[model samples]
Target: MSKFNRPDARAAVSSPVKTKSRASGRTYEGAPGHARDAKSELFLLAVANMVSEDTFYERAKDRDDRFTSLIHKLAVEDADWTARLLGWLRNGAHMRSASLVGAAEYVKARLNAAGTRERRTHEAGEGPGAAAFGGDSLAYRTTTNRRVIDSVLQRADEPGEMLAYWTSKYGRNIPKPVKRGVADAVGRLYTERNLLKYDTDSKGFRFGDVVDLVHPVAGSHSEAWREWQGELFRYALDRRHNRGTVPNPDLLPMLAYNLAFLESAGENPECLLDTDALKRAGLTWENALSLAGSKVDKKALWEAMIPSMGYMALLRNLRNFDQAGVSDEVAEQVAARLADPEQVEKSRQFPFRFLAAYNAAPSLRWSWALEKALNASLSNVPTLPGRTLILVDRSGSMFGAISQRSGLNRADSAAIFGTALAIRAASADLVEFGTSHRPVRFSAGSSVLSTLKEFTSMGGTNTAEAVRANYRRHDRVVIVTDEQAWSGYHGADPLGQVPANVPVYTWNLAGHQYGHGPSGESQRHTFGGLTDAAFRMIPLLEVGQNATWPF
Candidate 1:
C-alpha cells in the first residue's frame, strides 16, 4: 500500500514502452561494494551497519557504559552509512546533483535515536587529575573510547576524494549541517560560491582596526614607515641599555625620521640641525612601540601610524623571539618615557622612520620587487600539457586574474603559452582538458592564439574526471584546480578518478574573485563558473627571479 503500489501512473505509462532489461552479466545486485555506483553502495552500507551493530555489545550482562557511550558517539558522527543508504534509494550515484542533498533521512533518524549518557561529577577527595572512575574496569573502558574517537577524527583530516565521492554520491538527502560539513571539508579550496559582493564596493581599505593592518599599506606611511618602525624599536632598546648607536646604513632610517633627529644623532655630521634628539637619542619606532604594546596610540588616533618596520614592529611578542639577554631595565625606561602624555602622543602617532626611510630608499624597489618576484615565479611555471594533463582548476576563483590581470594573477595569460609548449616541441601527445570533460587537442605549429577556441570554461570542478581521462597517456597528471570541490570528478564515487602512482601536478588557480576556488593556497583553490576558468596569478615584479613551491 506504499508508494510501491503496483498500478501507479508511472507503471501505466511504461506499460506501452518496455523498459530496458536489467541485463545478464551486470545485474543490479552485482555492483561493486564501496564504489560510488548506487546499488552497490546501498547494499554495502546496510551490510556494514548490520555488521558493526551486531559486533557491538548490547547484551544486558555485557551492557558496558563506556562502550555504550563510544558507540553512541559513532552513531552520531558516522553519517556516511546513512547518507549512502538514502542516496542508493534515489539516484544510482554519479548524478551531478547527487552531492547536494541525496542521503539525508536515514542518517538523521539513526542519530536522533542514539541514546545519551549520564554526566560525571568529580569527587571532592580526588586529586585534580584523578579519573572519575575509581581505577576499576570502567577506567580502561572510558580511556579506550576516547582514544578510538581521537584516532578516527585525526584520520579524517585528509579525507580527500573518498569522503567527497561518498558524500557527493548521497550528500543531498543528508540534511543541512552534515551537508555543509561534508561540502566545506577540512581544506583550503578556492571555490567562491559563498562570497557576496557589496554594491559599489569601497576601494581596498584597512580592516576595521588601524593596528590590525586590514587595509592596504598605502599613502603617508607608504614610503618609509617600515624603516622608521625598526629604527624606533632598536633605538629604544639601545637607549635603555645606554648604547644609542645606529648600526648600519641599512638601519639608517633612525637618522632619517627627522632631519633634526639625524643631525642630533650625528648620522651624517655634515648636515646641521637644531634638536636635542642626539643627547637623548632619536627614539626608534621599536623604542616607542615596545612601550605601548599592541594598543592604539590614543592621542593621535585619527592619524595612521607606521612603525619602524612599517607595521611589523608594532606586532611584537606576536612572534616568538629569544630576547632574554635584554634587561627589565630597558622595558622600565621605555614605559616611563611612554607615560608622558605628550611624548606618548607624539611617538606612537607620528613615528617618523617609515616615511623618512621610504623616501630615502632606491626608487620604489620594494614595490618593484614584489611584482617582479611573482612574474619571475610564473616565468618558469611550465606549460600544462607540456608537463602532462595537469588538471588546472578553472573555476570561479580563477575569475579575477582573467578580469583584473594583476598581482600573482597573470596565469590567465600563461594558458596560451602552455599549449604552445606542449603542441610545439613535446614528444608526447598534447591533450587539453578543462573542468571535468574531455580533452581538446592542439597539434604542434597549430594556432596558439586561438588554442582555447573551443574552451568554454563553466561547470563545477571535476579533478577526478580530468585525471582518469588522461590516466594512461603520460607519466604525470597535473591538476590545476582550486581544490574547492564539495563533490569532485565522477568516476565511481570513491574511486576518485585519479590513478595512484600518477603524481597529480596540482597548480592552484587564484584570482581577484574571492570564493570561486581555493583562493590562495595554490593547488588548493579554483575559480570561474568553473567555466572559462576566469583568473590566474602573475607577479610581474619580484626580486628573486627563480623560485617556486615544490609541486
Candidate 2:
C-alpha cells in the first residue's frame, strides 16, 4: 500500500459540530481565529463559565454580559433548545449560578417576546388582550418557560436563589411563569431535612420568603403528607421571623432536633455535645464549631462531624482534619469514604476539586485516597488505543482564578486534566507550553497530582510553535488551553502543522469567543467544561461517529 493510502493514514473524518463558518476573528493574543455558531459558542461558554468571575482576557461584567446576551438571543430564537441547555447546565454539567442566571434570562426573554406579540396583535385590532390572555401560543411559551425554570432549580435552596437573582437583576416584579416554576420546584424540593440544611439567615431569599412569594402547595402525596408539609411551611415562616415556639417532633424531626440543639447550645456554650447527639441533632460542622467556641477540641469536633458530613465537606476539610490531629482510626474512615467510587460519583464533584483537596491537604496519608478519588472522578477520560500528545497551556492568562472565592485557577485545572489524560492514555507524551514547549517527564502509572508540580506559568501562549515543535506521528493530539494563542512567526494556526487525518481535540478551559484553530468539523474538535465529561466524545469521533451536544 502507498504510505498515504494505509488504513491508519486514511483515517475517516467526523464532524462533531455541524455548524458552518470560517475563521472570522482574532484571538486575544492575535492568532487567526475561528468563530462558532451561537449554540456552539454558548455551549462551550456555559460549561466553563464561572458566572460573574473575571478571566485573564475578559472582565467579570463583560463575560457575564456576553453570557446573558447569548442566552437571551437563544431563548427567543429556539426555546426548546435553550430550555434543554439550561436544564443540562444545572443537572448534567453541575453549573449552579450559570443555570440559575440562564433560566431567569430565558423566561424574561420569552416573556418579553410574548408581550411584544400580544401588543402587535392588539394594535392590528384582532381583539382586546386576546393574544395575551387567550392564545395557545402564549400558553405554550408560558409552559416552556415554567419548565425551564423548574428544571434548573434542582437543589432545595435554588428556588430561593433563583428568586434572589431575578429580584436583584430584573427587579421586584416576579413574572407569573417565574413564580409558577419556582412554586413547582418548592413543592418538590421543600422538606424538613432541606429546611434544616439550607434555610439559613445568610441567604437573602430564605425558604420562608420563597414559600410566601410562590405559595407552593405540597407535591404529589397523600392528604396526611400534604397537611404535614403545610405545617412545615408554617414552621419555616415562624422560624425565619424568630417567633416559632417549636416544630412538631413527629413530623419535622430534624428541624425540631436542630432547634432544640441551638437553644441548648446557646444556654450552655461550655457543654460539649457527643458525636451521637450532634449527629441526631443534624448540626453542620460550621454551626458545631461556632457553638463549641473556646471549649472546642478540634479533633473531637471533626470526628463528630465526619459521620454526618457530606462527601464534598469531607473532601474539603482534609487539611483541617490533619491540622486538628485527628486519630489514625478516624483518618482511615475518612480515607475509605474518599476512596469509595460510589461516594465520589454520588458527590457529583468536579475532577479539579480532588486536585484542590490534594493541594490543600498537608498530610501524606490522604495522597493515595485522593489519587483514587481523582481517578474515579475522571472515569469519563477515555484511554486511547495509541500514542497521544497532550499539550497543556501554562500561559500567563491561564492563571486567573476560576471563581473569586476559589483558589484553584484555570492553569491548575488545565494541568490536572492534561496530566490525567496523560496518565490514563495507553501511551502518551504530555507537554507544557506557553512561549516555549517541552515534554513533561512521567513514567508508566505516573501520579496525576505529582506530575502537576513540574508545570510552571510561562509568559505567553505560543500555541502554534508548541504544536509545530512537538507534533510527532501520534494517533491523536489533545490540547488543554484557554484558546488565546498568539500567531506563530509565520502567522500559522496552532493545529495547522498537524495533518487533518490525525484527530486534534481542544479541551478548552477558558471559553474565549475565538478559537486558535478551526474546529467543530473533521478531525478537529473543541469541548469545554470543568469536568472530564467532554472527553467521552473523542472515542465516539474516532470511531467515525458524530459527537452531538452532551445534553
Candidate 3:
C-alpha cells in the first residue's frame, strides 16, 4: 500500500500517475491527498539536504568539540559498524523509517553472537593457537597489553584512576608487584601535586577491573567538584578565624561561588561581581553606605557582605557548623547585621562561581517539594496556543544530551514546562486530548513527567502524527523536531483534515538556523543547534514570553 517494501526506502517522490480517477481530478488511492501535500514534501526535501545527520556531522565534526564528544558517545554506546557498512555497500540500504533502536538492537545481537562464537572457538581450540601469532607468541600478547594500557590511560583523568583502570583492565597482563608499585607511584605523584590527599602507603589501591562502570562517574569532574567543595567549606567558616577582629579575605571566594550559581540561572545579583560598570555606577560599599547614612561605614564592606544571611547561613552549615551550637544571640546578631539592604549591599547578589554554587545549593535541589511546586505553580501550561494537545517525543533520542547537562530529557521537560506555560497563556480551559501516537505504535494521553523518565532514547519518531493532530481545532499545532523524521513514511499527512484557519508550525529543528517568519503566512522560527535538544526549553520560554507564534 506504501511506496516501498520493508527495510528498503524510496526516494520520497513518485512519477505522476498516468491515469486519473473519474470521481476525482486525481487518485492513486491517496494520490489526491498526496498531491496536495507535495509542496510540504518538496520543502522537506530541501530541508533534508540542509540538515540531515550527515550534514550536521560534516558541519560539526571539526568545528565543535561538543559534537565530537557526542559522536564519540555514539561510537561507544550503539555502534553497528558491520551493518552500517553493509548499508553503504548496498544501493538501497538505508531507511529513515528505521529507528536507531533497531540498529542498536542489531549491534547487540551481533555482539552476543560473536561472544558465543569466540567461546565455541576456545572450547574447540580451533581459532588460531593460544598465541594469536605463530612467529612471535610472547610479543603478540605483550602488544595487546600495551594497547589495553593505552586505552585505559587515555580515559582516566587522575593518576589514581589511571592506575586503578590499568590494574582493573590488565590485571593478568601486569604482574601483581608491578601493579601495586604503579598504583603507589601514581598516588604519590597526585599527593605531591595536591590533587590527592591520601597517603599512597595505604593498601587496597590495586583494583581489579570487572568493568569499572561507576569509576568513570566517580573519577570525573563531578568527583573533583565534591572534594573541592569540602575543602573550600573548611576554609570558609573555619571558626578559628573568629579569634581575630578581621575575617579572612579568603572568604571572598566563598561568596563568589554562590554568586556564580545565581548568575548561571539567569538571576544576576549586582553586588558581588566587581564589574567596571558597577564601579562607574557608584555601587561601592562606601557610596552605598553614604546613601544609607550608617556608622558601619569604616567596616562598611565587611558589614554589607555579611548580611546575605541566607548565603552566609548556608555556608556556615556547609562548613559543619551546627545552628544550635551558635548562641542565639550571635546568630541573631549575624542575621541582623546582614538584614539591612544597605548593610548587605543589595547588589551583592552577583554570580561569581555559579556552577559550583548551583551544585552546592541543596535548597534548590530537585526534590519532592520542588516537584510538587512545579506541578502546582506551573500547572495549566499553555499549548503552542491553539492546539488541543501537543504530543512530544520522549524517546531517548528526543533528549539533547550536551555535557549530560542538557540530556534530551529537557525536550520532554520543555514540553511539560511549555505545556504549563501554554496553559498559563491561554484564557480558555485546556481540553486535554490524552493520546500519544508513538511511531509505529500509540499510547493514551499521559503526564509529561512520566514521558520524561520512561521515553526510550531509541524509537521510530512519528513526526506526522505530532504535526497533524489538531486539524479540526482553531488551535495552532507546533512540532519542534530534528526534521529527519525517522518514522517510516506515513503517506502524505492528513493536513486537509484540519480547518484551513488552524495553524501548523513545523519547526524543522535541525542543528542550524533556517531563520524565522511565517511560511504558511504564519510565523516560523527555525534554529540550527537546538536540534540536539539541549535548549528546547529556551525556545518555549522565549515563545511564552513573546507569544511569537508566527501566525
Candidate 4:
C-alpha cells in the first residue's frame, strides 16, 4: 500500500456532535471564538457544569442562568432528547447538582408550555382544564416531565434534594408533575436503611418532609412489601417529630433493631458496641461515632465502622483512618476495597475524586492503592494505536475550582485526564500550554499522580501557538482545556495548525459558551465531562462509526 493510501494514514472522519455550522463568538478572555448550537452547547456545559458554582471566567449566577436558559429552550423544543440528556447527566456523567437543577428547569418549561396551551384553549371556548388542554398530548407531556424528574433522582436523598431545588427556585407552588414524579421516585428509593442513613436533621428536606409533600404510596408490589413501606413511611414521619414508635418486629425487624439500638445508645453515651453488634444494628459510622461519644477509641471506632462503610464513605475517610492510627490490617482491607474494580464501578465516582483523595491523604501507604483506583476509574480511556498528541491547558482561567468545595481545579482535571491518556496510549506526546508551551516527558508506567507534579500553572492560554508548536505528524490530537483560547495576533484558531484530515478531539473541561475551534463537523469533535467515558468515542470514530450522544 502507498504510504498516503494506508489505512492508518487516512484521517478518521466522524461527527460526535450533531449541529450546524459554528457561528462567531468570543472567549471570556476576549479571543475570537466559534459558537455551537443550543443542544451541543448545553450538552458540553451540563456535563462539566456544577450548577451555581463559578468558573474563573464566569460567575455562579451567570453560568447557572446560562445553563437554565439552554435547558429551558431545549426542554420545550425537543422533550425526548432533553429528557435523555438529563437522565444521562445524573447517572452516566455523574453530575449531581447540574442534573438536579436541569430536571427542575426542564419540568418548569414543559409545565409552562402546557399552561400556555391550556389558557389558549380556554380562551377559544374549548372547555376547562384537561378538556380545554386536549388530554392526550397533555398526558404525554406530563408523563415525560414526570419521568425526567424521576430519572435524575437516583439516590435516596435526591427526591428530597430535587424537592428543595424546585421549591427554592420555582417556589411553594409545586406542580402535580413534580409531586407525582417525586412520589414515584420516593416509592422506589425510600427504604429502612436509607431512612437510617439520610433522614437526618441537617437536611432541610427530610424523608418525612418528602413523604408529607408528595404523599407517595408504595407502587405495585407484594402486599407484605406495601405494608412494610406504609409502616416505614409512617415511621419516617413520626421520627421527624420525635414521637416515632418502633415497628412490629416481624415486619421490619432490621429497622426496629436499629431504632432500638439508637434509643439505647442515646441513653448511654459511653456504651461501646462491638463490630458484630454494630453490623447487626446497621449503624452508620456517623451514628456509631455519635453514639459512642468521646469515650471510645478513634482507631477502634474506625476499625469497627470500616466493614459497614460504603465505597464513598471509605474513600473520604482514608485521611481520617490514617489520622486515627488505624492498624495496617484495617488499612489493607480499605485498600483492597478501594482497588477493587467492582467496588470502583459500583461507586460511580468521578475519576477526579480519586485524585482529590490522593491529594488530601497524608500517608504514603495509600499512594499505590489510590493509583490503582484512579486507573480503574479510567478503564474506559482507550490505548490507541500509533502516535497521539495530547495538549493540556493550564491557563489562568483554568484555575477555578470545579465545585465550591472541591480543592481540585479544571487545570488539575485537565492534567490528570491528559496525563492518563498519554500514559495509556501506545505512543504519545504530552504537552502543557498556557502563554507558552513545553513537552511533559514521562517514562512508560509512570504514575499519573506523580507525572502531575511536573505540571505548573502557566499564565495564559496561547492555544493556537501551542498547537502550531507541537503539531508533528501525529495520528490524532486531543486537547483537554477550558477552550478559552487567547486570540493570537489576528485571532487564530487553536486546531487550525493541524491538518483537517487528522482527527482532533477537544475535551472541554470548563463548558464555556464559546469554543477554541469549530466542532460538530468532520475531523473536529468536542466532548465534555469529568469522567473518562467520553474517551470511548475515539475508538468508535476510528472504526468508521459515527459517535452519537452517550445515553
Candidate 3 TM-score over all chains jointly: 0.30
**Could you give candidate 2's per-residue lDDT for residues 391-465 as a string of tens digits?**
999999999988887788988989888988888789998999999888888877788888888888788999988
Q: Cα deviation in Å at residue 325, candidate 2? A: 1.2
- Ordered by lDDT, highest first, the candidates read 4, 2, 3, 1
Give candidate 1 regions above 4 Å deviation: 1-387, 400-472, 484-501, 505-551
Q: Please give, for residues 121-168, the per-residue lDDT of candidate 3 as tens digits.
A: 578766655443243332223332222222222111233444443345
Q: After superposition, how far is residue 530 of candidate 1 from its true place, in Å?
A: 19
lDDT-better candidate, 1 vs 2: 2
Q: lDDT by residue for model 4 over 354-394, one digit each (tens)?
A: 88898889488898888999999999999999999999999
lDDT of 4 at 116: 82
List the candidates ranked by TM-score, beginning with the highest.
2, 4, 3, 1
State the number of backbone clashes in model 2. Answer: 0
RMSD vs true structure, all candidates: 23.4, 2.3, 19.5, 2.5
1 or 2, greater by TM-score: 2
Better of 1 and 3 by lDDT: 3
Instruction: State the lDDT at 356 in candidate 4.
Output: 89
Q: Single out the weakest 10-residue window by summed lDDT for candidate 3.
A: 14-23
Residue 239 alpha-carbon offset, candidate 1, angstroms:
17
Candidate 4: residue 101 Cα off by (Å): 1.5
User: Candidate 1: worst 10 consecutive residues by lDDT?
Assistant: 190-199
User: Which candidate, 1 or 4, has the higher lDDT?
Assistant: 4
The alpha-carbon deviation from the true structure for residue 258 of candidate 3, after best TM-score superposition, in angstroms, is 17
